[model samples]
Structures are given as C-alpha cells and as structure tokens.
Target: MSALVNMAAEVPENPLVPPIPELVIGLVAFFIVFGFLAKKLLPNINNVLDQRREQIEGGIEKAEALQAEAQQVLEDYRSQLADARHEAARLRQEAQEQGATLIAEMRAEGQRQREEIIAAGHAQIEADRKQAAQSLRQDVGKLATELAGKLVGESLEDHARQSRTIDRFLDELEAKAASDSTKAEAGR
Candidate 1:
C-alpha cells in the first residue's frame, strides 16, 4: 500500500480526470439531491400526473354520457316529429273527407231543390192552364148561347138549361179529343 501511494504520487496528473476528494464530494452531493427528489418532488409529481390522468378519464366518461343523453333526446325529438306529422296527415285526410262529404251533401241538396222547383213550376203551369181553359170555356159557352138565341130568334133565358147545354157540349168535345189522341197513339 505504501508503494502504491508512492507510485501514484510520482504519476503525472491527467487534466481530464477529477481529483479523488472532489469526485467523492461531488458523488455525495448527487446522492443527497437524488434522495430529496425521490422522497419529496418525485412523489408529488407522480401524484399530480395520476390526478391529471384520472381527471382526463372522468372528463371523457362525462362527455360520453352527455353524448348518449343527447342522442336519446334527438331520438325522442325525431319520434315526436314523426308522430306530429302523422297526426297532421290524419287531420288533413279527415278534413278532405269532410270537405268531400260536404260537397256531396251540397250537391244532393241542390238536386233536391231543383226537383222541387221543377215540380212547383209544373204545378203552377198546370194551374194557369186550367184557369185559362176554364175562362175560355165560359166565354165559349156564352158566345154559343148568344148565337143560338140569335139563330132561333128567341131568348131561351134559363140558367139551368144553359148550364146543361154547355156542359153536354164540352163533354162531347173532350170525348172527341180523347178518341183522336188514342187513335193517333195506336197508329204509331
């Protein structure tokens, strides 16, 4: 050992190599700093990292849950919209059916009114024709009685006799007209 010490002292000091004492002191300082970081700063940093990772995972889960809820809400809205559209269509169809029914009712009412008006018109015309015929018959009877009186050169003034003669003459004329119409129909 003494010989080794003497040999080391005689050796030239290399510029690159640290002296032994300085190396020892530097090594000791490095150990103290490493220990402090491992015991205190390293644990705190790891804990912070763990907290951050947990927060990120929680945030992601919350986002996924919110997205699922939003999707459900969207589905509900869409279903409601579809139902509303269906209801609207049904209402529109019902309205159209009601409109068609109303139109049909109106048309039927118009037809009924038209038939009534035509019947009323025919009845009025028949009444007017009968009145005219009765007036003309009276005039004809009066004229025939005056002519008969003139041709016979006498009054023949009795109400019952005049009525009977007029009635008999009109009846014979009606029979002739009826016979003529029947004969014409038979010919056709």
Candidate 2:
C-alpha cells in the first residue's frame, strides 16, 4: 500500500491525456450506437434486399413462362405450315389431272368434228357424182338415139331392129361411162 501511494504521487497529470472514466464512457457510447445501427438499419436493408430478390425471381419466372408459350405457338405454326404445303400439293395434282382430262376431251371432240366434216363432204361428193352420172346418161342416150337414126334409119322402124339397136347403144354407153369414171377416180 505504501508503494502504490508512492507510484501515484510520482505520476504527472497531463491535460492532453484522457482519464480512464472518459475512455470507458466513449467505449460505451460507441457500443450503443453500433448496436442500434446493427439491430435497426441492417435488418431493414436486408428486408429491402430480400424483397428485391423476390421481385427479380418472380420476373424471371414470368419471362420463362412467356418463352414457353412462344415456343408452343411457333411449333403450332410450323405444323400448320406443313399442312398448308400438303394441301397445296394436293390441289396442284388435282388441277393437273383435271387439265389433262379436259385436254383429252377436247382432242376427242376435235377428232369427232373432223370426222363429221369429212363424212359430210364425202356424202356431198357422192350425191354430185350421182347427179353427173344421171346427166351424162341423158345426154348419151340422146346422142345414141341420133347416131342410131343415122346408122339404121329405116331399119329402126322395125320392132326387132329397134330392139337390137337399143341394146347395142346401151352397151356402148355403159362401157364409156365406166371408163370415164375409172379415169376420174384414178386422177383423184
């Protein structure tokens, strides 16, 4: 106890040095301030950060859902495109078949028309030939009658002689007509 009193009496008091009591008071004040900030400010900041994290996560979930929906729509559109392509191909085939059928029908119709025209022309030619033969027969008969009158003028008055003359004239006319018709057909 005497030694401790001697050490205390030898220590010098300085205005620049803080006392132990003052140092202890400053430590207590700092602890209180830091404790208050830690309990109140840090928790509020954490809550705000947590809220932001939740919002960001929810936004990401919504974005993912939207992307999935868009993918489904794209798939559906691709399927529809394929179906449309098939339909177009089917229609093209049908159109080609129809066009070919129509062409065949038109060709058949044209052939029929051509044949009908040729048949009509042949019939007209046959009728004209018959008319020409009839006219030729009349003219030839008149010429044969005149020739017979000159060849056997008085003999033709007899019935038997007239019959013979008529038979000979008809035979000659038939031969000439056949020869002329053959020549005409060969020329054609």
Candidate 3:
C-alpha cells in the first residue's frame, strides 16, 4: 500500500498531454500510412468499383435486349394467330360453298332421274295398253266366230275369212259403243 501511494505521488501532473517527441513521431507514422493507402489501395478500390459499375450496366443492357427480343416474338406470335384465324374462316367459307354446290348437283341429278323414271313409266304403260288392246281384240274375235258358227252351222276355220269377219264385227262394236257413250253423256 505504501509503494502504490509513493507511485501515485510520482505520476505526471497532466496525463492527457503526450510528450512533444512522441506526438511528432505519431503524426509522421500516420502521414506515411495515409499516403501509402491513398497512392496504392485507393486506386485499386476505385478500379474494382468501376468494373462493378460496368458489369451492372452490361447486365442491364442484356436484360433490355432480351426484353425486346421477347416483345418481337410475342408480336410475331400474334400475327401468326391472326393469319391462322383468317385462314380457318376462309376454309370454312370454301367448305360451305362446296357443300352448297354438291347439294345443288345432287338435286339436279335427282330431278333428272325422276324425269327419266316418269318417261320410262309412261312408255311402259303405253306398251301395256297396246298389248291389252290387241289381246281384247283377239278374244272378242274368237267369241264372235264361235257364236256365228253356232248360228250359221259352219266352221270359221279359214284364216282370211275369219280375220275379215272379226274386223267387221269389231268395227260395228266400236261404232255401237261410241254411240252408246254419246247417248249416256247427253242424258247426264
């Protein structure tokens, strides 16, 4: 305790004030370090900062170019879509026209076929009517020949005589039938 007290009494009166030589040495050392940092480290730091700035600008430029390319691609896609829609509409219209043409052709063909069928039917009916008329004439002639043979006591076996008799009888029958039809109409 006595030694601590003696040491305290021997201590400098102004402890906050350093000696002049020490202050000068400290100032010299600080200047040397500051000068070295300013000459060497400061330039390296500035170069690194400039490189980083260039990299950031280049990245921004690349991003802008990519955005422009994407915009162009989107525009092209939209144009193609519009073209496709127009083509689809054109194809649909063409198909409708073709369908209408096909329907018209089918109707024409059907009409032609119907006309041909009607003509064929008329021809068939005429042929059938002629055949029936010929058959009725033959039947009436045969009946008349049999009745005449019974009445006159003779066989009508001669072809020419029989044909003549049948024609004469059919002509008289047609005349009588015509007169009868006229009388019936007058009565009506």
Candidate 4:
C-alpha cells in the first residue's frame, strides 16, 4: 500500500495543469480548423447572404410595378365608365326629343283627322236636309193637288203648272218665316 501511494503521488507533479506537449498540440489543431473555416465556409455563407438580399429587393421592385399597373388600369376603367354614362345620357335625351316630336306629329294628325271628320259630317247634314226638303215639297204638292181637285171638282193634272205653283208657295212661306224670326228678335 505504501508503494502504491508513492507511485500515484509521483505520476502527477501538479494535478491542476496539463503537460506542455499536449497543450501545444491541442492549440495547433484548433488553429488549423479555424483557418479552414475562414478560407472555405465563410465565403459560401457570404454568397448566400448576398443572393437573398438581391432576391428580396427584386421582389419589392416587382410588387411596386404591379401596383402601378393596377392603378393605371383602375383609372382607365373609371374613364370608360364615365364615357359610357355620358353616352347613355345623350341617348336618353335624344330619345326624349324624338318622343316629343312623335307626339306632336300624332297630335297634329289627330287634329287634322278631327277637322276632316267634322267637315264630312257638316256636308252629310246639308245633303240630308236638302233631300228632306225635296221630299217634303213633293208630299205637300201631292196633297195640295188632291185638295184642289176635290174643291174645284177637277183634276190638277198639269205637271208644269203644278210645279210652278208649289215653288211659289214655298218661296212665300220662307219669306214669311224669315220676317217672323226678325220680328221676334226685335221684340227680345
């Protein structure tokens, strides 16, 4: 046991510190790894960072361009809408004017037709009155001839004389009626 204790105490001169050769070898290995990373891996990382930055900037520029195009399209749509509205208004106004013109023409045609109808009616009434007067004259002449034949005890068969007597009687009757109407107007 004493021998074993002496060997363990002699094996390590200082327990807190490593041997010099081992420390030197470890420091050299660490420097070799750091140099390899700086030479090869660092440049690759820098290239990736630069590529990502460029992509982000391009995306922003593209988004801005798209936004501008959208704004232009919106403006064009608004302009077209305004033009359409104006055209619609103009068409409406034109339609109204045409409608008014049509109405006027129709009204004038109706008035003309009314006047023609009234004129035709007046002409028909005049013709009917003349026909009735002629018929009445014939009837009265016949009755008068019959009465005269009965009173004088002879036939009134002379056509020309009978016509002249009837015409004279009608003239005298018309004159008497006109004078009576005039006297009535004066009295009123």
Candidate 5:
C-alpha cells in the first residue's frame, strides 16, 4: 500500500505548467533580447521617423513658398496686362483724334478751294460778257454809219462825227423803247 501511495504521489506534475528552470531561462533570454532591441533599434527607428517628419514639413513649406511666388507672378502679369490695355486704348483714342483733325483740315482746304474756284468763275464770266457786249456795240455802230451815209447821199468819212451820230441815234432809240415798255405795262 505504501509503495502504491508513493507511486501515485510521484505521478507527473501538471502538463500545463512548464518546468521552473526552463521558465527562468526563457524569461532571461526574453529580457536580454528586449533590452538589446530597446537600446539599439528604438533610437534608429525614432531617428528615421523624425527624419521623415522633417522632410514632410520641409516639403510643405516649399510648396507654400512656391504657391506664394506663383500668386505674386500672377499679380504682376495682371498688372502688366492692364497697363498694356490702357496703352492700347490711349493709342487708339489718339489715332482717332488725329484722324478727325486731319479730316477737318482736308475739309477746310476743300471748302477754300471751292470758294476760290467759284469766285474765279464769276470773274471770268463777267469779263466775257463785257467783251461780247463791246463787240456787238462796235458792229452795230458800223452798220448804222454805213446806212446813214447812204440815206443822206453823202460820205460820212469822219470817224468822230460818225461816233457822235451813232451815239445820238442809240440814245433816242433807247428812250423810245423805255416809253413803249412803260405804256404797255400801264395798258396791262
């Protein structure tokens, strides 16, 4: 009975639990590995993370600066465009003014030339009329003198006497014609 009780009491310990020695050795190895990783790899990982953070921040700053520069350039370009538009408008207005002035000057010159031509034409007509009237009067006077000499049966060869006779005859005829026109008007 004693031997059986001792065998039962010496039965294998619980299978769920590890031996003490192995547990102790495993804990030591785990501590050593954990310490080495914490000391050696943790700082390196932190340094890499910090470097990545700095790079991201630098990239953001650079992008912001570029955006600001782009904005400035856009503003400058807009200003230059406005100035160019203003200059173009001014030039167009000036050109229009000059064109209008030139047209006015040309119109004035044309008007002056037209007036001068009209005056010259009127003078030329007056001169021609006077010349024609003088020619007709001379021809009439010559015919009258020839007729008078035939009627009188005497040669009126004196030029001064012939002129005086023609003048007297023309004055009497004009007076008679005037009296006849007046009488006709009164009868109407």
Candidate 6:
C-alpha cells in the first residue's frame, strides 16, 4: 500500500490530455444543453403526459355514468312490460266472463220466447175449436128442425116443437159424445 501510493505521487500529469481552457469550454457546453432540456423539452413532455392522464380519467367517468343510466332505463322498461302484461290478462278475463254471461242470457231469452209461442198457438187452436163448434151447432139445429117438421107432419118452426126437437137432438148428441170419448181413451 505504501509503494502504490509513492508511485502514484511520482508519476507526472499527462500534458497531451485536455487543458484547463478546453475543460472549461466543455463544462459550459454541457450546462447550456442541460438548461435547454430542463426549460423546454422536460416541461413539454410533462404537459403532454398530464393531458393524456386527464383524458383517460374523464373517459372512465363517462363510461360509468352511461352504464348507470342504461341500467335505470332497463329497469323502468321491465316494470312497464309487466304492467302491460297484467293489464292484458285482466282484459282477457273480463271479456271471457262477459261473453259467458251474454250467452246464458240469450239462452234464457230464447227459451222464454219459445214457451210464449207455444202458449199462443195452443190458445188460438182452442178459440178456433169453440168457434167451429158453435157454427156446427147452428147448422145442426136448423137441419134437425127441418127433419122434425118432415117426420112429425107438423111445423117445427113453432117454439114448443122446436124445444122438443132440440131436447131429442141433445140426448142423441150426448150419447155419441160419450162413445167417441171412450174410443179416444182406448187408443191412447
């Protein structure tokens, strides 16, 4: 260690190397370059990096807001769709019930109308039978009076003769009516 130290001290500095004036010029050039880079290039680079960071953050916030709004809209639409379906179901049920009730009422009305028509027809037949019986009785009575006048050799147009003839005719008519009723019963 002592020999290495003495040899380093005895060695003379090389004159061929850079002199003090050259060294000073080199130092000055290096300081000027470093100052220019710090003032212009470094500030421009920092500004560009800051702008890029701000743009990225803003884009992330906008995406989150759009996602939230879309979720809200989707929920609202779903609720509305459910409400519409429920309303449609209610309307369908109501329409079906109304149709059933109307059908029942129509059936009842038709039955009533049919019964009324049958009753009217029966009443008309009864009235026509009574009218025909009265007309037949009048014609039969006139013929009986004529026949009695011929058979008895008397004027049956007189009241006493007419009464006797009608009495005989009624007795024969009652006997015939009884016989016809018995025949109808046996047929049934």
- Which candidate number would show the highest lDDT if scored against the true structure? 3
**Residue pairs with clashing backbones, model 3:** none
Evaluate model 4: give its lDDT: 0.92
Clashes of each: 0, 0, 0, 0, 0, 0
Which residue runs of candidate 2 sit more than 4 Å off their true CA positions? 1-30, 142-171, 176-188
- Please provide, for model 3 over 1-188, each residue's C-alpha lDDT reduced to its tens digit, 9 standing for 90 to 100: 99999998888568788878999999999999999999999999999999999999999999999999999999999999999999999999999999999999999999999999999999999999999989999998999899999999999989899999999999998899999999999999
Which 10 consecutive positions of candidate 6 have the poorest summed lDDT?
156-165
- Model 3 misplaced regions, further than 4 Å: 1-34, 172-188
Ranking by lDDT: 3, 1, 5, 4, 6, 2
Question: Per-residue lDDT for 1-188 in model 4, tens only?
Answer: 99999997777678568789998998999999999999999999999999998999999999999999999999999999999999999999999999999999999999999999999999999999999999998998888878878998988799998888778878898899999999999999
lDDT of 6 at 13: 71
- Model 1 over residues 1-188: C-alpha lDDT tens digits? 99999999989999999999999999999999999999999999999999999999999999999999999999999999999999999999999999999999999999999999999999999999999999989998898788888998988589888888888888999999999999999999
**Better by lDDT, candidate 4 or 1:** 1
> Which parts of model 5 are misplaced by more than 4 Å?
1-35, 165-188
Residues 2-85, model 5: lDDT tens digits: 999999889978889998999999999999999999999999999999999999999999999999999999999999999999
**TM-score of every candidate:** 0.75, 0.65, 0.72, 0.78, 0.65, 0.66
Worst 10 residues of 2 by lDDT: 154-163
Clashing pairs in 5: none
Candidate 6: the clashing residue pairs are none
All candidates' lDDT scores?
0.95, 0.88, 0.96, 0.92, 0.94, 0.89
List model 2 lDDT by residue over 43-82, tens digit each.
9999999999999999999999999999999999999999
Q: What's model 2's overall lDDT?
A: 0.88
> In lDDT terms, how accurate is model 3?
0.96
